[model samples]
Target: MTVQFERRTDRPDAEGRCTIHLRAYFEGQRLRLVTREKCLASEWQTDKQRFRRSKQGYQDANDYLDSLAARVQAAYRQLRTSGIEHTPEELKAALAPPAPAEKPKPEPARMLVVLFDEYRTAQSARGMRFNTLKTLNTSRNLVAEFAAKLPKGLTLAAYDMAIHDRLLGFLRHEKKLAQNSIWKVVKHIKAMLAYLNRDRGMPLAVEPKQLKAEWVDVDKVYLTAAELATLEAAKLPVGLVRTRDAFLFCCYTGLRYSDLAELREGNLHDWSGARVLRLTQAKTRTSVSIYLTGTASALLDKYLGEGLRLLQVMANQVMNRNLKEISKRAGLRELVEVGDYRNGQDGQATGAQV
Candidate 1:
């Protein structure tokens, strides 16, 4: 048998670096194994079977090739001394690095829960809102539950469309959630996976197209002009008065809850005898100028002397609950189906309200 270092000229890496292999010839058969050294073909010496001392890593490559050659020769001598006949494949196997101690496959990477926790921490540090964070936590919990059901559990390497398809089926049949709600979960999953891959330098197993969420068309409901007047004239209880006023102001000026909560007297201006509120949207950070209606102007007048926050904004849950009561008291029981178009209202408006 004969073993020699041969440069592989046909296959080159992305950087045009060619690898050298130990080619074994015996009994009309040949076998080859990579030597884990790479360089330009021009930097190699054909007769010397080593890299020339011309490149940055040439010395280390030469030493490694020498060590590999010694191992192959030792394997050949050992087989002959033992009076055993071996094929080229057997010699190559004998020269291999003792089967690498058979590592336990690296424990199958980390659990998805760990990555989700890190993502939540980073998001909180970046000032995500409480409601948005809460929704993401819900999604993360669902993902954890899904992972627990699997035999191998979840890891970044196992995030593929198969898992996604199964999760969609679980959300639909097992959790009995509608497409819209399931879409929310998928949205959070896509965002978190993107953060891990693009932001945190983790590799994802699935393509971006595989992670796409299906959009749903939702029916929106709005208060008609008559309902608006009823809400304005309704004598709400002391608790709902703030929420009622805020809701009415939103209906008039089309200000989002985030922008309205942060609105102050400083945002109000007299633009050629017209009262206008100028501020940047908290969600998008875009500048906005809202001309006030008569009711909007009156509502601002009521809260003008308030502190840094122009209005008394309650927790989202409290505000939503109180608005439901306000709707009942306004006697606008008619189911009003509204479109998704904002016209000039808040950009995030998409749902229906009575």
Candidate 2:
């Protein structure tokens, strides 16, 4: 087998650049293919199969030709090693490397906010619930604030133990967030990483499991029977009547604000001389049968009777604000202590009232 180079002066371009080609001869057959390199005819050495040393860029052009010849020789050696009979065309084609693929343009540098936007878009497409989306937005805002303080900014591919530890420290020591709240932020970061690596095709440095969610059980504050009675009987302002009624309704029916918002007169059915709520929970999408207490029954009768609109529930934000005011008016101002699990240690917060 023999590989040879030829300069085609007949096809010289306007700039006097001659096309170079490779020829293979084996077993009385010949194969030829054009190489993409171009050089001045005077600079090319047909006999030496390389560019002349005296010409500009001679070293690089000559080295390219040498490597091309070496690849052809290597192909021939490989065929001989395989003990297979092959034609000159097969050997020449084998020697020709496939053209390098055009690389995609480098993406603009991504920040935490950019990825968070993309994540939220994808979640919206998946039909995430409003509350769930709100939670993610809250977490992302905190993440963005934390990322802004970082030296080089947050990158999808740069997440590691150092970033994780620093973020936790920021939330715990600087922000004074509970461990469970920090866990929520970490969960959001994990989801963002998953979207980057799996959906956006970015290579991430850390695994999802590396950002393990550490949760601490927290004792929630609930209105006691006495406190609830005080709230129910307390003369609230005209603006807080709906809020007071809704709070008492929740206490009696054990329904979430979301489920309570979805309640309608149609959902209240008569059963065995008493009223029962039969409705599909908005959060869980599961049907529940709640036997209404006398208070719940009376509230339902007053608000959702005949063709009246479902309980006159206010916006969640408004409801929370009014509830705080009502609680203060009702003199339910005992300092509450909450326990948390932080960094595998027991932590407690005292004199926290809201």
Give the C-alpha miss distance for residue 349 in model 1, angstroms: 3.5
- Residue 36, candidate 2: Cα error in Å is 20
Clash count list over all predictions: 3, 0
TM-score: which candidate is best?
2
Candidate 2 per-residue lDDT, tens place, 47-67, comes to 777888667888887788778
TM-score for candidate 1, residues paired by index:
0.54
Report the Cα lDDT for candidate 2. Answer: 0.76
C-alpha lDDT of residue 239 in model 2: 92
Off by over 4 Å in 2: 1-104, 124-131, 144-155, 158-176, 220-222, 301-309, 312-322, 334-353
Candidate 1, superposed: residue stretches over 4 Å from native: 1-109, 120-178, 198-208, 211-213, 270-274, 304-307, 315-318, 335-354
> Mind giving the per-residue lDDT tens digits that candidate 1 earns over 1-354?
677998888999998889888887767877688877888877889998888888688877778887877777788789879887777767867876665566566545967777988898899999997657876898898888888899989887888888889988888898776677688888888888888889978888886557766767654556778888888899978888998888788778767676676787789899988898899776566788988878788987787777677778876546766776777887877643212224454233322345
Q: Candidate 1 overall Cα lDDT vs. reference? A: 0.77
